[model samples]
Target chain A: MINKESVIHTRNLSRSFGEILAVDRLSLAISRGEVFGLLGPNGAGKTTTVRLLAALLQPSSGEASIAGYQVGIDDQEIRRKIGLLPEAPGLYDGLTAEQNLAFYGAMYGVEEISQQIKRYLELLGLWNRRHEPVGTFSKGMRQKLAIARALLHEPEVLFLDEPTSSLDPQAARLVREFISDLKGKGRTIILCTHNLEEADRLCDRVAVLNGHLLALDSPIELRRRIFGRKVVFHLSATKTEFEPILLEFDFVNHVEQIENKIVVAVDDPDTHNPVLIRALVEAGAEIRFVGELRRRLEDVYLELMQASEGIINGTN
Target chain B: MERIKAIIIKEWREVFKNRFVFFTVSFLPLMITALPLVILFFTGRSEDFAGVTTADLPPQFSSLCSGLDGAECMLYFIVTQFILLFMMVPVIIPMTIASYSIVGEKTTRTLEPLLATPVSTLEILVGKGLAGVIPAVVATWVGYLLYAAGAHIIVSNPHVVNKLFDPLWMTAIFVVGPLLSLMGVSIAVMISSRVNDPRVAEQISGIFVLPVVGIFLGQTTGLILVNQEFILWMAGVLVVLDSILFYFAVQIFQRETILSRWK
Candidate 1:
């Protein structure tokens, strides 16, 4: 059943350019206020998907909607209800920051524009520089201004594509925090990015795409489902002595002794960790620390890429 | 409707704020108009002009020089003929501004955000078209007024003012100038949307001046005798041409198409 709170919904959406299929049969349902990330590599149709949903591109097939408005039929209405920050900030460099925001505010027909512009400029920490020409602003500052431009009308849904591609660490963090705050305001967001860490940290559910949907789930769920559970135990004594003893437990899927740490792969660490700990202690092995290993999303991403590659090469 | 107005205002602001566009839009009209007045001034002053009489002038110019001597007749002929070339001012200025408008947005990567708004394609087209046409038309009229004043002062003849501000000249400046400006803007809009580079779009739309020059050529070569009726007919043809170009411009302006095919 489609959730009533779903703000973005697509049914087998596809777009093609000449002979190239940029996006193919992508289906998704993103709930209101959810920060849904479309994760992919370069040329993986992430940008294409964002354009389609934003009504900047027409799908070659299927259907999509924003706030229950169909993409093609209700394009203007959809546009009115959505804010889009394209890959480039795309600021009118000749205009001052205030002018740019005001232009967009009027373009979106937002009433009380002066107050809206003031509110957004202040919220984005750009009020002091509002009078400065955007031509003089740095990439990050232009991006923040673009964000404020997108939000000036207070759209219900926001789309950001590669929001922090070229920013310094400090600027990237500021943008991330701003996006997090926007999410807190209950505005549904669709973030398209190649930055795996940003996606892992910010997305409630990420759709891994490569011309087609590969995997769709939370980061932790993807890691656990694809690579299983792994726990590393720091032992006071040689790990070799504890490895074989710990391996004897039927619940322990696999064990490896590396220096002072015994790494164990298990079906369910939450269920078997206590039993494994008692067995190790009863067997005269001193365990200092036992915790689930933090699996990097990069690993799962790479693993999925490799699997997709194999499938492409007909060797999967 | 408000969206179109906003876009027009934004475009006007951008045109004024851009130093290069500002300089050209401000000076080109004065320069084009003032050149003819200067020539008329120098010719009126030269004493050697006694050798050439009104009979030596083209038969088509005979009516304009009826009350004048050799120098004054020569001045009248030059002023009237060169004013046709002044038509190039409106064509170039508006076309220059409109040519760069869309393609410049594309280069700066600003078109996406503008297109992402709720504004219709026709609104964007009209806003930008008017942005280009309004300034060009204003400049042309102001330049014509200045030229008329300068001619009246420099030539030291009240009839010179009478000849320059004739009903025909008024029709050309008021009717032909705006329609030609709209045509230039329409061409620029059509070409700019297709081209990625602003320079290329400007160059292609620069072809607009050729037809005005063509009329000048016809008048110069005696292929067509220039008169009030000729000017009125030209304005009529321009009205039809402006309408055709406008229809195609709006039809060709697909927001999604530009966003998709843009490089």
Candidate 2:
């Protein structure tokens, strides 16, 4: 559950572009020290929400605050608390790695900007090429410089958009590690990404924002609440027509039968599995493997998207 | 103040770093000084391009204006035109620099992080205006100096240096230059704050300079006389324009609107 020490609070926030409603009354409280993930498909308003929180956009209606400051009115104070890594942020192609950092640091008004510039360059492993123009740096290096720019002011809240989009495996790992480090320091974070695995790993709570919020909960709560019990029963038996025999069981929701193998979903698969085995032997059908199935975060994500589509069509 | 200083320093470095910025700033000054030298070369050490040598010029040129001769008069024409041309640069730099200041960041998608900083819209505007204005004003003086040096050498008149500096030109640079620069910076910044597309902002911001150029043409064609009274009147008019520009530019710089439309 989102707690009382929320750094960001949005109330009935809505944005409409002509007839198109981009964000519809999006209201949520993000507590301090939590990593909140905003997951949605392309054009699902994830990016819009990030921009709103960053005080970059004027809401059509409603209100939002960062660190107790209103979005637009007290913009400077809000900006002080939040740092954003914008989507598709480009590098100054003519500036070297160190120069870019120094430029941003100065713009951010980071104290001892030169020292911070050195620290960030070294942290991102761009120390070796600190003098090389960002145009000459690799994609991973550019992204790293952008991140350093984000952190230059040491903001209390961070908004990371697709933070690991272009990184190599090692680089992605380093960013993830850095995020964990930030969270450990009690800094709030808002992340917009499609990486389901990363979401499961890094976030404390995730909101599936399709058009409106389809679901909002911790990953574990979502998985448990959305998907019922998954029971995988392995049955080996005579290969003669076992598929039809398995379908006869009333409790079976879906039955996929392979030659001498089957996967079944039932309200009570535990009770149903035994009955299926007995029926199979009676019918002289072969029974193969039987056990519980493993459910993944992907399944939960898809189900949430579908549920949201239903929500849009006015189905509960 | 610290933030402003930081922004100005960083912006100065950026202007120096970009080849386009360097060229735009330096090209005019080099041309300004070199024109008189070219005329002297073609006219056989005669500073006057109007075909009247300093030796045969009016007594006023050789007496009231002690340093002025036939060639020095021609040199004055060059400098005056250069000053007029220099007025255009303020508008130009602001267009290029302000177009990229915020709108460029939006295009790069860096506007998000920039907006997320603790800096106010006013602070941001001040920082950006300094970047565009400083280079433009400095370039005008640098170019004028080079022109004066070339004129002094080419005129070959020992007295030319004495009249190379004029009270009128000095007043123009010190007074009108900053006013015009502020006008440019303000209008360009206002345009940048409103739009998301850098190209569109650049184009829109650029149109504001037409009136200034029109005034220059009017003066050139004698449609408007630019006596001391006229200069003072026009300066007053520009100050009013500058105030209006400053007021709306700040008002239209709605942080929420920019942030929202920016995305």
Whose DockQ is greatest here?
A: 1
lDDT of 2 by residue, A1-316 (tens): 3345988899988877778788888889989889999998998899888877887776789899988889868766777777788776566766677877776676676789878888878887888898887778777777778888888888888899999986799878888888877777787889998988888889999988875777888887787677755455455544465556767767776777665556676666566767876776687654455676656667899988877777678986
Give the residue spans of candidate 1 off by over 4 A: A1-4, A243-250, B16-19, B45-76
Clashing pairs in 1: none
lDDT of 2 at A208: 89
Clashes of each: 0, 22
Docking class of 2: medium
Per-residue lDDT of candidate 2, residues B136-235 (tens digit): 8787777667756765666555454444455656656667877888898888888888788766876887788788788778766657544456667768
Query: lDDT per model, in order?
Result: 0.86, 0.73
Give residue B213's error in model 1 in angstroms: 0.7
The top-ranked prediction according to lDDT is: 1
Q: Given the true complex, what DockQ would model 1 score? A: 0.78
